[model samples]
Target chain A: MKGLIVKDLLLIKENWKQLLIFVLIFIVIGLEGNQILTFVPVFLSLMVLLSTFSYDDYNKWNSYAVTLPNGRKNIVRAKYIASICLSAFAILFTYLLITISGMMNHHLNLEETAVTLLGCWSAVVLLQSFMYPLIFKVGLEKGRIFLFVFFIGVSALLGLVFQNIKISLPVEVISFLNHYLVIILPFVMIILLYISYKISEKIVQKKEF
Target chain B: MNAIEIKGLVKKYDDKFQLGKLDLTIPKGVIVGLIGENGAGKTTLLKAILNIIHIDSGTIKINGEDNKKEEKKENIGVVLDNMFFPEILTAKDIELAMRGMFKKWDTQVYYNYLKEFELPLDKPIKALSKGMRKKLEIITALSHHPDILILDEATSGLDPVVRNEILDIFLNFIQDENHTIILSTHITSDLEHVADKIVFIDQGKIVLDQDRDELIDHYGILKCDPSQMEQVKKEDYLCYKKNKYDVEFLVADRDKTRKKYPNSVVDKVTLEELMLLMIKGVK
Candidate 1:
């Protein structure tokens, strides 16, 4: 697993210039007082980690990975670990950037920032939960298209649900669900992510190079 | 114990092609050449031995342990026809990656091989020529001191000079008595120079498996006309091919056949000729 992680880090390092550009772009946006855009850095990190799969596909690295010791299961586990590590890094970097920008601008609300970051993290977890199993089952190319469609469907459903709540649900009931959702969503996403990893393992185990 | 023991290995790929029940043993300390034409199940057999592909029904043992177990793979090194390194990585990065992956990886040996092969350490893999990439792959495969090296067409695209150099490295690799190699290629002449044993597969079946010397020295292709061929006993030959002008028989024992058919032209066989006759000739 350490070997797989090191390889992925090296792969990401190859595209460091692009990553740096993303960081600069996020910092500029944060300086502009766009609090919501703070999540973009974490999202970019996720995209970068996912791009490693495209690299693996082009190089046929999975075939080579299976030839190494502790290959199959470790390879899958390494992806998950790397994803978490990069997300942590991205979150820390963005948090520092936003905090500094907020101090200078005097417009940042700490509690609101915490809630938004938590929401972003949960969204990422849920996205990965759906994305990984798809990638493991079909592969990176087809999985990317499926992921796009998945996100569109999810957005449309959320939009419909919000519209229904605005039209039909009373303010007290809506606020009650919203108040608890921030606390409960992370736990639910964690459980779903765990299940996703297990599913990925099963899909990868039966896969042929 | 054999380096690799495969029994009843079967892999089906749709209706037209299937690797039927097959059995093979690769003894330690010898270079076993797997010869086959394109789409002849050579890669499939190698993949089965490595457990890269799931078998339908069979058992593959590597050094007496089940091949499916990840621990058994630690003893094996593999080089597939296509290069598997990310183009963005340098040879140095590969060394770092491999050091973490293989417990016995020798960084010294890896660098030594890179220097010997004239592979640029800092250059990205995509910048290297085809032969250089092949050399890098071979270096990685050998640096860990794997007991069994399985190569599937590892030398197909290289020039003869480079191929000869790689073959020399293979020859040196098997110098350790515990080390073995399974080289799969259509380049029979390369096998003629280095291989100890030859196994030929055609249409997903093993047509011939014999000691290299035995196949070259003992096996004979007897060329004769119909009347002369009639004079030779049918049971003396394994298989025969006939044309309008002459008849060719693949005889197992050249000395015996030569002595028995004193008047017939009994010539020693080449691995290429043997493969062709076995695959194309009637049984």
Candidate 2:
């Protein structure tokens, strides 16, 4: 498992220049007051994590990988571990960039930044929770195409639900939920990540190369 | 104990291709060359042994344990054709990754091999030529000090000099009486240089498995005139190919066939001739 993680990390490092360019472009956008750019780096990091799969597939590495000791299990586990690590780096790096941008613009709202960071992190991680199992089940190329269509369908369904329903919550209930959401969301994401890991493990266990 | 044992192995790729209901046992401390044409199930058989692909109904044992056991994989090294690390990775990175992957990965041994082969440690695999990449894969497999090496087309696509260098390494590896190797290739001459045994597969089934010396010394190709073809007994030749000018027979017992047909031409059968006759010749 450790070896697999090291391999992915090394692959990412090989593309460090590309990643650095992305970071710089996103930082410039963030400095220009495009707060939405905060989420871009994390999303980019996930894409980087996913690109490793393409690399493996290109070389048919997975077929060779399974011949190694504990390969099937370790390969799956390592991707998730490396993902979490990449997510952590992106979160921290984005936070630092936002801080610099905020201070320069005389709008250093640390509390708001923290909330946005949490929401962005959760969104990206949750997206992966849905993506990893599909990737494991089908494959990276097919999985990405499937995910694009799946998400579009999901967004349309959710849009329809919200457009038809108009329910206003009480101020007290809204405040209560918002107050506890920061604490609740992390646990929820953790559980989702665990479930996603389990599904991936199951897929890998039955997978032929 | 045999190094590997397969019983009733069957892998169905589709309606057109399937491997086995096959049985094979390879004893320890010898090089077994697996010879077959493309799509002949050589790769499939090796994949089945490595448990890279799930078998339909079979049991593969390596060193007396199920091939699926993690411990059994620890001592086996493999170089599957066109399958390896991502080309973006350098040899140094591979060493680091393999260190954690294999419990017995020897960095010293790996570096020694790289130095001996003149493989640059810092160059990404993509930058290296085909021969260099192959050498890297081979040394990576060897660095772990595996008891058994299973290679699929490991020597293909290289110049003769590079192939010779790699074959020499394989020969040196087998000097350890505890080591075993199963090399699958269509390059029969490579096997002729190092293999102790040859196992030929045709159309997904093993057609021949015998000691190399026994095969080379005993097998012969007898060429005879069309008029003299009647004198050649069907039982004497394993297979025969009839042409306009002469009738060629693949006889398994060269000395016996020569004694039987003293006036006929009986030449030594190379591995290539043996495979060609066995697959392309008539029964």
Candidate 3:
């Protein structure tokens, strides 16, 4: 499992120049205090992770990988571990960047930055948790297309429903949810990730490369 | 003990092709060459032995343990046709990853092979030529110090010089009395130089399997004129072909057939001729 993670990380390492360019672009655009900072970094990290899948596909790495000492379960486990590792790294880097930027601009609010970082990380992890099982089932290429269509369809349906229906949460209910969301979100993320990993494990176990 | 044992192994793809109800036992410490034409289930058999593809029905044992058991596979190394590490990775990256993946990965040996093969340590695999990539894959399989090596088309595309070099490596590897190799290739010439045993698969079945020396010594092509061919009994030859000027028969025992028909020409058979006669000749 560690070997698989190391392999993915090594693949990511090869693209450092491209990643550095992205960081430079983020730094320039982020000076305007745009909301892109938190989400973009998280998304960037996820894209980096997804590219590893593409690399694997292009080289037919999974066929060779299955022949290694690691079993199918370990392969799935390593991907999830690597995803979390990459996400955490992205969050920490963004946190430091935002803190330093905010300090330089005389508008530092560590608490607010923390909340935003948490939200971004949660969103990325949730997306990844959903995406991995699908990728394992249909492969990275087709899975990405399915994800795009699925997300667009869901968003459109939700948009139509909200546009037609008028519902508002009470202030107390919203505040109560807000107060506990940080605590609850982590548990939800863990459970979702676990389920996703299990599904991927099953898919890969039966998969013939 | 046998290095590998397969019983009633079967694999099917859609409804078009199926590989067995076949059984084969490969003894340890010898190079066994698997020879077959394209789409003849050579790769399927190799994959089944490796447990890369699940068999529809059958049991595969490696070193007397079920192939599904991961521990048994720890001492096995493989190079599947056109399958390997992502091309974007350098040899150095492979070294890092393999050190963690294999418990007995020998970095010193791995680098030694890389140096010996003249493959650059830092170049991405994509930059290497086809033969270089194959050499890398073979060396990677070797660096783990595996007790068994299973290779599918490991030398199909290389020039003769590189292929000879790789064959020498296989020869060296089999010096250990415990090491075994099952090399599948359509190129029969490669097998002629190094194989101890030959197992030929055609249309998902074992057409022939025998010791290399015995196979070469016993199998022969008996060529004769049309009238002379008439003297040959139906059961005497495995298969036969009719040419424009003469008729040719694949005889199982050259000396026996020569004695039986003194006037007929009983000639030695190459691996290629045997495969062709067995597969393409009329029974």
Candidate 4:
């Protein structure tokens, strides 16, 4: 596992500048997203985590890595752990900055802030769990295109129906942490991601090259 | 002790190629040449030995352990054409990455190869020439000091001078008797020079497996008239090729063929001529 982390760390260091800028754009766009950017860090971190698979896919490095001592299970776990850690880091960074700003404006609450961060964290985990397997099974270029078309088309059509239903401020998604499935969902995702790794390994093993 | 034991190996692709039930054994101290034309399952066989691909039904054992066992990798050093290291990485970066990965890694030996190969340690691998990239892979593969080295067309693209230097290094490596190498290539001349055993594969099956010197001695190229080809019995020879001007035959027994055709011309068979006659099926 340490070996796997070092491998990725080396790669991350080599490409950190480009990667930092890529994630910065996501955080900026998420800040301007429909929800006033309270959960922008969550999306930024999720995108970073999700895109790691694409980075591996850029060459046949995934297969080459599989040929090493660590094997594929560790490879999958490292990616999951890396993403989770990055996401947590992003949320912490966002919380720290927002707290400093809020303190300056004299409007800070500790309990509410933690709860909201956890809610957004759960959503990002859910999105990644559902999305990464597809990206792994297919690839990033096609998978991201499919993601954009499906969700954007659905939301565009729903915009008409949702306008009639009404809201105070774009359906406060952070309040949805009440469900028990949110807790079950992340574990289920981690498990599914693991299984996907094995499946992908098996598929890759059968490949000639 | 056999370095690698492959028995009843069968790998079939859907409507494409088939690796027959291959039975092969490479003893602990010899360099074996896996000679075949393109798409002859050389890479497939190498991949199967590494357990990078599952065989349909067969068993492969390496260094007394099942090839399927994950721990078997500790003893094997494999360099295939497609084992692409990230082009952006330098040899120093690879060194850092592989430090703890291989238990037997010799950093000094790795550095020695870099010096011997004259590779720029800090240059991005993408910036290195193709031969230099190959030297990089070769250096890394050898750094681990694996018991068995499986090379698949690994030296095909390099110039003869570099290839000869690397081959000399391999020859020195196999002098230990604890080291064994299986080199797969269509370039049979190199095999003729150094390979102890020549395993000729075609389409997917091991068609001819023989000791290199024994193979050279066993067969002779017979050049005769077309009429003389008709006179030679098919059962007396393994394969024969005929053109409008003359006839060529790959005789299993040079002495017998020489005796039978006293006026017939007999020429020594090189690995290249032997492969061409066999694959082209003697017209």
Candidate 2 share of real interface contacts: 0.84
What TM-score would candidate 1 get against the native?
A: 0.94
Q: Which candidate is the best by DockQ?
A: 2
Total backbone collisions, model 1: 0
Model 3 error, position A172 (Å)? 5.8
> Which residue pairs in model 3 clash with each other?
none
* Overall local distance difference test of candidate 3: 0.90
TM (B chain), model 3 = 0.98
Q: Give the TM-score comparing model 4 with the true structure, all chains together.
A: 0.85
The reply for model 3, stretches above 4 Å from the true place, is A31-35, A163-173
Give the per-residue lDDT of model 1 (tens digit) for A1-209.
78889999999999999878877887888887788696897788789888898889888899889888878898899999999898888888878877888888987787777778877888788888889889877889999899899889989999998988876779998899788988887789879989999999998899998
**Predicted structure 1: lDDT:** 0.88
- TM-scores for all candidates? 0.94, 0.95, 0.97, 0.85
Q: Candidate 4's residue-wise lDDT over B104-155, tens digit each?
A: 7789999998998899989988898878888888788888888888888878
Identify the candidate with maximal TM-score.
Answer: 3
Kindly report the docking quality category of candidate 4. Answer: acceptable
Residues A8-116, candidate 4, lDDT per residue (tens digit)?
A: 6666667779868865765555434322565877786676555556556765666556556645555666766777777878788777756765566577775667667
lDDT of 1 by residue, B1-283 (tens): 9998889889999898899689998889999999999999999999888778899998999999999899667778889988487889999999988888898899999999999989999999999999999999999999888989999999898899999999999999999999999999999999999999999999999988899999988999999997776777879998888878998899999999989888889999888888878877877
Task: Compute the lDDT of residue A28 as modeled in candidate 1.
Answer: 88
For model 4, report DockQ. 0.37
Model 3 chain A lDDT-worst window of ten: A29-38
In the order shown, the candidates' DockQ scores are 0.78, 0.81, 0.79, 0.37
lDDT per residue (tens digit) for residues B101-149 in model 2: 9999999999999999999999999999999999999999999999999
